[model samples]
Target: MPLSEHEQRMLDQIEQALYAEDPKFANTVRQTNPAVHYKRSIVQASVGFVVGISLLMGGMILQQVIVGVIGFIVMLACLLWGLNAWRRVAVGGEAAAQSQTKGAEPKQRRRQQRPGMMNRFEERWRRRQEGDDR
Candidate 1:
């Protein structure tokens, strides 16, 4: 449901107050993007993976079992980390695309566009708010 006029006004007032109290913090929060963070993580993980490869090779050449084991562990960890970040980016990109497409639809159509689980949860919430126990 859309916010009531009073609620909207109050929210606007709160936002203005926050900006006035600390414009720098507010700006930083507003400009921060999760995708950028994910991309950076991916780059870091890739570099770590390369380092692991070198360590593994060096350990092999030096005839050190411990170093080779440690390098293998590092490579495995970095591979998992990079894969996780990539997965998050893909999921987030899908959500962003869905939201953008949703904005183009009519309001009535938008209401019908909610996923089944979300619709059920909203319905239950509405029932509880209206004093219906079942």
Candidate 2:
């Protein structure tokens, strides 16, 4: 549902007050991009994965089983972390594209119409289990 004119004005006033109270903080919040954060996470994970590979190789060269196991664990953790960040970025990008295409539609309305991430994942899992390639 669209906001009433009075509600919109009130929201605008509140936002203005927030900016007035702390321009720097408000600007920082406005400039922050979640996608950038996710991308940074991915880069960090990639670096950690490389470190893990080096550790694994070093362990093998030094004949240390414990070091090798630790390296494998680190590799697995970084891989999972990177994949999670990638999925978040993909989902967020898709939502942004959809919102742009939708023009001025209320975000609440769009959210209600769209399936949640978990629902989409569950649906995909079901399809895979059923051998539906599509």
Candidate 3:
């Protein structure tokens, strides 16, 4: 729902107060975006993968099995992290695109197709509450 004019004014006042008290924080918060976080995560994971490769190579040269194992673990972790970040970015963009498209599916159907963890929990909680009410 759209905010009322009074609510908008109140929100504006709150925003102004925040900016005046800590402009740096307000600016940072405003600039921070989900896409930015995902991009950073993917970049960091790629860097970590390179470091893992170096570690593995160094371990092999030094004949240290432990270091090699550690490097392998690090590489696996980075690969998973990068893939997860990519998935999040893709899903978020896809959802927005889907929402904007003409002849979009009903919200109920779309939601049922992909019930997230929180959604499942909420459903369970609602059922329990209804049971208690009876």
Candidate 4:
């Protein structure tokens, strides 16, 4: 359900109060965009992957099985991390761009209508905990 104008105003007031109470935290949260962070992570992972490949080849030529295996593992990990970051960047960036073009009315409605995966998981966890307490 969309918030009524009165409720929206109240929520805005509460947000303003929160920012006033902790300007630093509010600034940090507002300033950081997850898509940008994900892109940076992808770059770092690419560099790590290249290093891992060099280490793996060097270790193999040097006849050190342990070193080679470790290098291979590191390379695999970096590749996986890079792929995950790329996925996040693509999804988040696209969603952000789409939202800007379409405007906030539909976006807010969609957000309000659907509970996120984390919210559902948290709800289940809370129920389990309550059951355990009893």
Give per-model CA RMSD. Answer: 13.9, 10.8, 12.2, 15.2
Clashes of each: 0, 0, 0, 0
lDDT of 2 by residue, 1-134 (tens): 57999999999999899999999999999899999999999999999999899889989999999898899899999999999999889879767767777875677687789998999999999999999969
For each candidate, what is the lDDT? 0.89, 0.91, 0.89, 0.88
CA deviation > 4 Å runs, candidate 2: 1-14, 93-134
Query: Tens digit of lDDT per residue, candidate 3, span 17-112?
Result: 999999999999999888889999999999999999988988999999999989999999999999999988886865575665644557657878
Model 4: pairs clashing at backbone N, Cα or C within 3 Å:
none
| lDDT, candidate 4, 5-79, per-residue tens | 999999999889989999999889889988889989999999989888988998989999888888898899999
Q: Model 4 TM-score?
A: 0.57
Mind sharing the TM-score for model 3? 0.58
User: After TM-score superposition, what is the CA distance of residue 27 in candidate 1 from its true location, in Å?
Assistant: 0.8
Better of 1 and 4 by TM-score: 1
**TM-score of each model, in listed order:** 0.60, 0.60, 0.58, 0.57
**Candidate with the larger lDDT of 1 and 3:** 1
Q: Considering TM-score, which of the candidate structures 3 and 4 is the better prediction for this target?
A: 3
Lowest-sum lDDT 10-residue window in model 1:
107-116
Q: Using alpha carbons, what is the TM-score of model 2?
A: 0.60
